[model samples]
Target: MQTDPTKDIGSVFGRSWTLLSSNWIIIVPAIIIGIIAGLIAALVTPTYYMDTSGVYPVPVYHSMLGLSLVVGTMIATFVGMLANVVILTMTTGMAAAAWKTGKAMISDGMDALRRPNVLSAMLMLIVVSLVLSLLTLVTLGLAGLISLVVFFFLIYTIAAAVVGGFSGMDALKESFEVAKTSWLTTLIVVVLLGVVAFLATLLAAAFHFVPFIGPIIAAAISGVIVAFFSLVLVGEYNDLRGRAHPAVAAQPPFTAPPAVPPL
Candidate 1:
């Protein structure tokens, strides 16, 4: 069994920032792509309002199935699938770069996008999200508390999928091991990232109220959020892998001391 490498939560964050800064060239474009995909997803996503008080206006439709809902669902599902592919491609590309060179690149990002397994990763993302959502509803919002504790483990799945080409189940299993070994660190990082993400969100919301530049800034913030969070996972994975398989020390050669010539 591979030993756990993660030791310091603070170091992980530092490494993540280092990686993100080093890969700014690639991350910038990737962030833009992420923003665009998000926009597309929003455009296609189903929108409906329900009211038990009968105060809301409902869409007019003749069919019992509600044509608007059917069409919206189909459109959203198709667009969402495509969007998932795009997003995973970007993330995996960064992960691949991190694995290979401890850095990131747009080209590496593009290459990773071409891999077939990114689809599997995307599927895993969707499935896990749905499961979590259902679990949340079933538990009457209690799952939110549970997720606050274990959601960090999901980052491992993404790392496993990208770096090792592991399938969803394999990623999940491996993630559990990594998470088990570094639970405290994971918790700390997750909490910190959550705070950062929250701050970014607030900033984005503030920017949303600005003029034209405000929208652009908000979009940029969204992309930054995605890029930073994903990059941190890459850093953590690198740390974990290093700890598990440290470099072997080379054997020292025997050397003879110079003979005394003064005698």
Candidate 2:
């Protein structure tokens, strides 16, 4: 058992690629999802550029202070926080759906998509992301780390919600319980993934000097990398869930202990 969370980074990366390849039909739809997201993002470029300077105030501080400096700072902080919440929520939901869809393709072929539970899982994912984002803000960003710990658990919960027919919040709570068993591993994975994502963005920016083609290429590459990493994180979440919870093991059938000889 690898104690270091970072140690599993490579393994997760390899597994993600393998999973994607093995379930290409499902993976293809995931890529399509990415492309659609990217297209929407692209379409909003002008609006984003125009609103770059706009900011919203932080709810609490904004109401308390009337000073110009304080107001400006609060506004910027609020906008930044809100934007992050929205973007993360969208991506997380998409990633959760993609992972569940991929697994379904591998296990039950195309028929898996027909299940109503699948749509429910995707819907619940968006809600979870929103809840997590607000939770992070309430904790003054401390929940960022907590978010990492529950990262995979959330995905697994989404899968369970879809497959086992669990309620969204119930599945989320179950994931948190399972994640607690391997919190350290989860932390390391989160840090390493964060580093990789940052570096990928930096590299993508290097393409900006190429005139007309640069920005487009950069956007496409960055989008793909983002999509790939999102899937990897979700895959890792699935792996961790099985490892942390014996009842959810993928191998031999898990049997419940006989009801303790009635009291």
Candidate 3:
């Protein structure tokens, strides 16, 4: 059966929270590793401050320091990218669990990665990301206008492929179809979820104050946010999908009229 499209979009957060809080025990382990990685990112990432309050040129770092800074920044950039991917895949595991599979618990979500079709779905995800990244850049962020309209749209492709066992092409078709339901609501849900993601960063920063397990704390926080966000996607997808194809009663099969006298 299809979901009711008239549901209040704002309540998505409340439903997400309810689902997440209810499944904490099953959700925590999967995300802790990712949040820990984010915490490590904070440590390796350098902080720069240039005091220009002095003379016209102001005080700048020494030549050696400048060269070192450039090298450090380059290395840090690479490392940060890797950390980001790790966190993305980790949280994506949760999203897949909630979207592709029926269960939303952490373990089931993590286990989604082990599915045979997951490899294809993941490859598709990477392809979509690269193409979208290029498109968004080529437009000088203008593609973000479209992205805002359908940023989470492609995930539907992967979800259908994995969950519904549909072919990649079919999944791709379904994604756009479902995306057409309510652009405004989709955009709002995305922005709200992004705030939760940023909160994971804040949690990582806060956990840095902890003694030995700071990174671990951060990773756990990040994971929890992913779980909540994933559940929200599940709810939103159902609503939009229902709007796309509302349920219809099954039709009765036709029966041939009883044979009468031959003509």
Instruction: State each model's CA lDDT, in order.
Output: 0.66, 0.55, 0.58
Q: List model 2 lDDT by residue over 137-232, tens digit each.
A: 789998897776456556345444443455646656655664576666765665666787788778769888889888766766555554465566
As for candidate 2, its clashing pairs are 56-75, 152-237
Off by over 4 Å in 2: 1-9, 18-114, 131-156, 159-167, 250-263
Per-model TM-score, in order, reads 0.70, 0.53, 0.59
Is candidate 2 or 3 superior in TM-score? 3
Cα lDDT of candidate 2 equals 0.55
Residue 234, model 1: Cα distance from true site in angstroms: 1.2
lDDT of 3 by residue, 1-263 (tens): 32543456667667667656655643464455445554665665556666566633433455545666666655555454444433444444555554444345545545655665655555555555556666876889888767654556664554555454555456666666776555556666777778877877887899989988986677667667656665666566655665566651133435899889878
Cα-based RMSD of the predictions, in order? 9.2, 10.1, 9.8
Residue-pair clashes per candidate: 1, 2, 3
